[model samples]
Target: MEKLLVVEDDIGIQKQLKWTLDDYDVVFAGDKSSAISSLRRFTPKVVTLDLGLPPDAENASEGLATLQEILSLDPSCKVIVITGNEDNLNALEAIKLGAHDFYQKPINDEELTVIINRAFFVSSIETENAKREALECEDTPIIGTSPKIMRVKSMIDKVAPTELTTLLLGESGTGKDLIAREIHQKSRRNTKPFVAINCASIPENLLESELFGYEKGAFTGAQKTTPGKIECANGGTLFLDEIGDMPYPLQAKILRFLQDKVVERVGGRTQIPVDIKIVCATNQNLREMVLEKTFREDLFYRISEIVIDIPPLRERNEDVLILSRMLLNQCADMLSKKFTGFSDEAMAALMAHSWPGNIRELQNKIRSAAVMSDTKLISVMDLGLDDTHDELDFSLKVTREKAEKEAVSKALAYCDGNVSNTAKYLGITRPTLYHAS
Candidate 1:
């Protein structure tokens, strides 16, 4: 059963609430001290706090202090402040201090139950979105050097030094997030936090709180004050991936923050100043979305200050075999396979196929091939590329160059592009690999 806490100072009302709320696993406290104590012990998702407590029953000072303390302890707790009919001003102040909702004197059991249920529902949604974001942030770095990808690297180098809002445009699985991380790593605030949020993964209702955070008692279940992504990324970079999927209602708030560099948490009257560099990425065309009235024009122009277009793997033909060799070696080591290299037909197959999922798809295929291959060399059939035709020549110089390039590429990839380790792996000096490339 869902847990609920009732913080009523009145003996009669406390008993009445306990009777009406029998469906919940209810805990009770008659004063501010006991209420806070119960809050810590039970950690209930919902709390009904009475703004009139002992020693200040006629005033809201003690009750308000308890509310603040509860929120300080657990920002995610939902707090419903119960107040007298004449204490409307105090109730409003409680809300401003982060109380989720307030009920007047002589609370109707049915109405209050409805509000509590809604609070639980909203909290559940926010919690799920938080989990999704956690999963999305566990991503690897970008790995490629096609001329198209080289151009993107050049663009990142050029833009990383600036405070200009950057927008990364690419298809899904094309490493937009990795590029975002690269930008954050290269920027002046590299030492600070690099907070990233996937706009598409979070629910629309919860996105606002997740972005801007919430004050204690901000909503039904908010028990404490917690900083949001924007606040967490203060003095650093805020990467909003899948920016095109952000809800239209939220566009105005984002645009406002971009303009003012300030954020006001939910149920908060004070504006917190935040100094953050904004980086956004999206697979969809925001310009087209803007034309279609789906995306905001001002927000689009603001975020796309220096847009970097990342070309997909299918378009970067030269990068295929190089990346494949790198991924092949990586998979071989990870899977404990003694695969020496890809066969001639395998190379042709790697070059021939159009990778719809880009580098991500390539990595998966190579990993699968490495595990499935029985021979020392990965065959075309092992790579699931039997239909592809062999286009490579069988000349001595050409064969030698291909072998050298593949070995060097694999070594460099495994060593995370370290020159010394790559040279050591190939049993040669840095200059030799440098000259070959």
Candidate 2:
């Protein structure tokens, strides 16, 4: 249920109001202490607050105090102040102090319901916008000049000209965002802002304001009017990252925006139209999110208007060496080091190693090696792969035996065959020495 808290000192009015909003999970607070207790305890996203309380019902002082406390405790809480119908100025002051909006006394059940429902609706939209941004931020720049990398680039060059809402599917750290930006940069919208937001990182409560903006006094703490990311990126591309994590309700709103090219601000009455190219990226199976009711089928169709699935690092082995060199150069330049190259053994290790972490892992390892290596060229030891040399350094069992025999023979030659001393010095028993000979 959508949680809501109604704080008023009048017992009859409180009980009657609670019954009216039976659709919501309602919590009532008769006094300031109880109200704050409920606030911190539940952290309700939307609050219905009376501006007149026990200590100062004739004035708004007590109610204003409660508003300030709510904002201080949770700056994002949407507190709708309840004031006497004649107290317009007090309501405006409360707005400045961060009240979401105000509802006058002698409440009209229908109008109050509209305000509360708007809060819940707007709060839901904000959540989905944040998750969309999270999906976007996880991408990176695909750095390489290999034939395979070049082929991927070729596809990007070709497809970027269209108005398709490209969906880039790849593992984390594979530079999906980089490719997304590249497509946006190459497209007709190159000059416009390439606004990117991660969907998963932002909380659902504030995500709406971040995307659709809100009217001044839309709720307590919505002090001044502000435009969301969507308005900020009017003519540019709005890249929604991790689109799958977007809450279901928001998916519907986004689909609405996609269809009508218009958005309504949180607690807003009129629709705000926006024009921009939309590009989304995600690693999750959105098809499954839709199946489980977590993702919207309509939005999946809206964003996946075009899909570009980039191959993972292991699948594109041909680009490994090329990507490594480029990434190493980036490290060298960033670290201000002149790394000559990798040692022969180091090169072999780099090629042989199974890089499960993809380009990002290799980049970090090489960057570290470049900073720590003593020689101009980094060695296998520098990359922490010296154990890999074991097989390559050994030829056969005879080689091991001959090497041991030569060592014992040399010691004997030096000591003129002092058997007891030689055995003791070599830290070996006589039986072992006899077997070696």
Candidate 3:
């Protein structure tokens, strides 16, 4: 049973509440100091605070102070303020001061019970979501446990220590930049600079000078000589984002630099020697571009010494809830809101929607929902997503059976097909596991 703290001064009322809210392990406190002490010791998720306490029973001064202190100690604690029957103003004030809800002196047992249960439910959801977030590996840059993501991580671990020119292929917003940085961090040149340049974002005429620096008199705006991204990334990693968009003319120069490990400034004959690891990312199909004569075939081969393909968000179904919970927590902290988690409808909408924009789209939806939502739980409407999709099946029995089957299969695979170990891992009996399988 969950713990509940009752901060009533009257002995008769305290006994009555203890008997009424017998569903919880009730802790009693009559004054402000003892209330705070009990709060610290028991750490109850729900607290019933009475405004009529000693020293300031006439007004709501003492009780209001206690409410602020309780919230200060544990901001997530649901404080249900107990106000007088006629104390409408103090009740509103308590709510404004961050009390979860206000209750009248003549508290109906059933009504109070419902409120307490709701608070407990929200608290449990938040706690479990937080635990799920904590389960992610801190050392990894990527955040997913799906088979596709696990394979990507394993490939990264293997290739990060090598000097191969890696090419990452994926759709936009698939976190290609993150993978580049992870590879750089895990490489021998981690202590050196890691420079990035987007081929598509920069202008065509200036892209060459951006990759290979220009001399002081190279152009009208070139008043001073500057090192290009490649030179700056000496003994480090150079991340060429959207490499497929790099101009065909500039590809020859990049290939020359890669082959010779030397750079020549624009309009300068000096050969600048630089040792750098190259990591390129592109959302376009480079092979098709090469066949169409848009991207140079030789340059493609030079850059793609090793290729890593990132799976889109739509294909990573198992990671949707994990990423959503993590992103929601981030948005809540950034917006300073006390959001617990998504509602069942919102979760169904998240699973049903095809994330064309990938992780970036998911992030935007979560942040927008956090800003627009008025309650602790985010709804499908708050996410601005259609929940009535044909793909969504609201059958509880089917959903449970599917989830159980997947869990058992994965557990069995993890345990090397050992039925006893799989059952132990799933916290189910051997017979139950066999039936589920």
Residue 227 accuracy (lDDT) in model 3: 80
How many clashes show up per model?
Answer: 13, 25, 0
For model 2, the stretches where C-alpha displacement exceeds 4 angstroms are 1-142, 145-148, 385-437
Candidate 1, 280-342: lDDT as tens digits: 999998889999999999999999899899998889876787678768877777877777888
Off by over 4 Å in 3: 1-134, 391-437
Q: By TM-score, who's the top model here?
A: 3
Candidate 2 Cα RMSD after full superposition onto the native fold (Å): 34.6
Cα RMSD to the true fold for all candidates: 29.8, 34.6, 13.3
Name the runs in model 1 displaced over 4 angstroms. 1-142, 389-437
lDDT of 3 by residue, 1-437 (tens): 46799998989888788878866668999999999999999999999999888889888999999999999999999999988898999999999999999889787888888888788778877876775565663687588877898788888999999999999999999999999999999999999999999999999998888888999999998999988888999999999999999888888889999999999988788999999999999999999999999999999999999999999999998789889988999887898889889998899889999999999999999999999999999999999998786566745347667877888889999999999999999876898788789
Q: What is candidate 2's CA lDDT for residue 180?
A: 86
Worst 10 residues of 2 by lDDT: 389-398
lDDT of 1: 0.86
Candidate 2 vs candidate 3: the TM-score winner is 3
**Evaluation by lDDT, superior candidate among 1 and 2:** 1
In model 3, where is the ten-residue run with the lowest total lDDT? 389-398
Ranking of candidates on TM-score, top first: 3, 1, 2
Q: Judged by lDDT relative to the true structure, which candidate is superior, 2 or 3?
A: 3
Q: What 10-residue stretch in candidate 1 is worst by lDDT?
A: 131-140
